[model samples]
Target: MLIMKPRILNGMMICGTESEMRYCDIGELHKDFHLGTNTTIDFIMDQYDSGFLLELCRRTAQIVYKDIYQQLQQGNSAVLIEHLQYYLDREGGVFDIKTVQDEISVNVSKCPMLSHITSNGETLSPNIGDFLSDFYGSWGENTPFIISVDYTYPEESYCIYIRRYYAS
Candidate 1:
């Protein structure tokens, strides 16, 4: 049997992979984080009082991005979780990706995402729901998070990828 690729998969281009790409849409995304109440960016700019929300969103994005980037570099699940937790525990109004790398370093663990979910949650099942739940619980109502990881092997047995999207 032969398999084809999807139009979009994990922020990558898969012309001839083992199978089609899969995408999972997480609703509401960062709405709980309170990016905006009812007004749009135009209104915020006109009012000249949207700095707070904007700052929060920017910081949130930076934190999430840096965390994931570092996690990937470490290549270890436990270290990734610990590193993220450390960042979350820190006190900083502005989010800076460079700062995260400076503070701590841990051994790289394969599949850092799984490690993150495992440490945050007591039990982790193969089900994606379990991972989502763990993420939601860890980030809390104020923290916004998004992730996208692609693993493909056209010549291998199969391809596996995970993606996370964040919005406020």
Candidate 2:
């Protein structure tokens, strides 16, 4: 008898040689921090201020994009969005970016982090989504054009990110 592995096996994709790092490692850290798992995810994000979380996102993005915030300051919304999409894809994210004048959106069918964590038989702390939300939100706030990362419903795995740029 042979048992074949499914492509979408739970948590199997994480912590493997094929991928850069085991996303489940973060979950383990959260556990070691004495935080409960498999629940409490929503409470965390709701408690944190969106602006503050977004600020963190901005700082992190600066490092990843190599100070491309300079271009963002020049009101290059499309360029920033394009760069972000590339980075996300390279990092194992599955999504497509759609851009309209002064507005861009990411239609994500599979969120790599969440999928891996759930696959590994663990629950995300509330902080996880909060981190992601603020990060995306912060990305919107970076450009000279005022941008907003809009979260789509049902706000879970198959979520949508809409970033709107109001060019000043």
Candidate 3:
């Protein structure tokens, strides 16, 4: 059961699959295909726990960090922020960033995935916290500057994504 908003966003064709796939403008890879929030969460819950997801993300992020860590340092830490924005924006997520001294504060008013799922009547999985936190923690692995991340769960307000980096 794909739960889609009444409107579909802009997207190009995705080739090379068992069948041809179509992407919603606001999806990550295949995260938001024809499915809405509840369906996706149910799918995730069926497959893995929050800790498992976090460990998966941790190992994945570590690999990605190792491969691009040096390239990221070659220019600016803001590059990582830009990439983050790019992925989230792809799904029409709302986020704001404030930078002062060496810290980056990201306020996520509406997350494209979790928030979207919640909107569609899905209760968040218990493992969701581990998934979010460890994913952020993995970014600390290989940085030219020491980086610390703090994540706040979305409550009455929303979750916050904060990154503190030692500036070179």
Candidate 4:
């Protein structure tokens, strides 16, 4: 039996067949529309259009990496130290700010499709790792293909969104 996997990160959701995964950014496109980044984009494709969604995912990453990667590369000791301090304070994983920055330096096409098979009526919620564990069933023997980011917004309700890409 084939298994299914899904990964979400950084406000992007990529899913669908292995051969042709679809990536999307519902929130970014919404903001882009309001900002008139491209007035003609709407006439070309609506939110439901997978192509439009994928484009948003690609474009958003371009914007993010371009804006942040270089600043990290500058070796501005103060800024890097500040970020390192914050990560350490939070008990996050050990990571060098510059190294992390380098991961997202180049564009990557990370797909977020939740599973390999969509049979039955079982639609896995993005929050359920158990549902996705199937993709990693071989004790990490197989290539790691899916991941998710869990975040809590201070003073706001809990929400789970698939992080579409990982810099690492």
TM-score of each: 0.19, 0.53, 0.59, 0.20
For residues 1-168, write the lDDT of model 3, one tens digit per residue. Answer: 123343433444322212111222332455544234334434566786555665666676666554335444453555456556655666677888787776666666667777655665656654455555566656655554444444454441244444445555
Q: Looking at model 4, which ten-residue stretch has the lowest summed lDDT?
A: 102-111
Which residue ranges in model 3 land beyond 4 Å of their true spot?
Answer: 1-52, 64-68, 72-75, 144-168
- Candidates 1 and 2 compared: the better one by lDDT is 2
- Candidate 1 deviates by what RMSD? 19.8
Task: List, residue by residue over 22-50, the lDDT tens digit for candidate 4.
Answer: 22222222222222322333333443453
Q: How would the candidate models be sorted by lDDT, starting from the highest?
A: 3, 2, 1, 4
Clashing pairs in 3: 3-36, 26-91, 50-127
Error of 2 at 12 (Å): 28
Give me the runs in candidate 1 sitting further than 4 Å from their true place: 1-39, 64-66, 69-168
Better of 1 and 4 by TM-score: 4
lDDT, candidate 1, 125-158, per-residue tens:
3223322233322332332222322222111111
Q: For each candidate, what is the lDDT?
A: 0.32, 0.50, 0.52, 0.28
Q: In model 4, where do residues sit more than 4 Å from their true spots?
A: 1-48, 69-148, 151-168
